[model samples]
Target: MKGLLVLLICMLTATSVFAGKADTVKLRQHLIAITGTSQPRNHQHTAALDEVATYIKKEFEKLQGQVQEQVYTVAGKEYRNIILSMGPADAPRLIVGAHYDVCGDQPGADDNASGVAGLLELARLLHNHRLPFRIDLVAYTLEEPPYFRTEHMGSYVHARSLKEQQAEVKGMISLEMIGNFKDEKGTQRYPLAPMKLFYGSRGNYIAVVQRFGNGSFGRSFLRNYKNNANIPVKSLRAPAFVTGVDFSDHLNYWHFGFDALMITDTSFYRNSNYHQPTDTIYTLDFRRMARVVDAVYTSILNL
Candidate 1:
């Protein structure tokens, strides 16, 4: 645990060249606070997830955007998905989201705290940028098991509401686990042999995962990102049923027939600490994490 503390402190020490000094400060503070586990249970003092949403909403509001809360009840308890939007309200929308809940009591730094950090950092960068469509930075809840893949998932509720309203969604971008990275040979693992052959065995790359037959957004975004970002990027467009393909908040959007993709570090494929108590901020690479956020920013700007 002492070693872990040292490593987590290193996360704060990184001078993020990609995110700029000011944005890096916001990312560090938010990531540290978000990963401080309160160990709340679903039916008990469930303020843990609520706290994450509140912090994210406050940060977004600080950047001069209005925050909205979509409240839904599950098992008689209220859960919220916090949102902030920019650009024309009636235009087609681009949803960027990350779930803030861990699998259990662990800190879950890489499992999702890193992703939320990316989400927050992106929100900061997009504060003044304008696009033809609206962009929403959403902080979702209840993404981990025994709630994962269930309709009660915060993302499911949010996605269903969009479908019900018949909102014209351009695409959804879900940040799953975007921090952890490794450069050593054989450091990365894949669900199948062919994927390893296609995407490579190095775990140092961030990937865009899309279901086959989905819209061309993922590929176009990947192409733009490849041109402007300094980090390595790979893309996977496979059967939706493939293991690890439809694993995050993006899955809910896919289910609603909206094009969606996940940006991630491949989760358990490269991080052994996933879902474990050791999955603290120590294991994350925030500099590279910042690059991932910058890559997404560049991609969206070019799109």
Candidate 2:
């Protein structure tokens, strides 16, 4: 009995260490380094974005995965979306995406760098893992203002093309913001009133939000993530007309009739530094971010 107790304690200790390693400050520093470009406008951050994409591509390639670049021009400036493929090409595809662009003023650490970091980590974790379906890890270019909700939205372009070509996209998941959390109550807010009852005021839980027609996907994802992830999760599905309902890149896929949902930290609602210059890397909780990435990877593989 003593030996068994010792083994259990050791196992718990090892798990705690692994979790701590995943949440290191280095992940946040890496995000800040990438978003800290010379110029925020005029593709000034393009090179930085490319550097991140290159790193992700190389990591996948090292695992013998396939990588593709989808280059597109926006307002006379060039931007590229990096796509990494795992598993058979002919299998049904599930896209996991996050935009790498920042607004002109801020580094966009929590606005999106958090999401990008999560996506990159997810790619690394699932690179060589055998899965039943094809998974595409996409790093999109323009998901912020001037491009958001417009025809030039990178996700809009990609989803529209798929719709036009009749591409077989089973589903898509967008990681908008996943690195900020607060354990205190009343730290979290919502666009609607009734949501306060369903979710806690603490920002520790990851959110799986979808529109009315896409609630099933949100519910399923929440169930899968909650069952597999170490952290808490909350799901919200409302009509598209609800304010702040269509807030992320997932909105584009919904426009194309594809099953899609946004896996977010409820940007602006809980993130105090949503789009400000103060939204730096120091504000995120990378440990929680890593767990979210792990849950996303598991969910996609199972899908």
Tell me the deviation in Å of residue 196 in model 1: 2.5
Q: After aligning candidate 2 to the native by TM-score, how far in Å is the CA of 10 from where it should be?
A: 14
* Tens digit per residue, CA lDDT, model 1, 182-263: 9998999999877787788899999888988888777777788889677898888889888999999999998899989999
Per-residue lDDT, model 1, residue 57, is: 84
Best by lDDT: 1
Alpha-carbon local distance difference test for all models: 0.84, 0.77
Candidate 1 stretches with Cα past 4 Å from truth are 1-22, 40-45
User: Which residue window of length 10 is worst by lDDT in model 1?
Assistant: 14-23
Report residue 20 deviation for candidate 2 (angstroms): 14
What number of clashing residue pairs does each candidate have, in the order they appear? 0, 1
- lDDT of candidate 2 over 2-91, digit per residue (tens): 999999999999886444334345466558656666655214566666776676566556665788888888767677777888888888
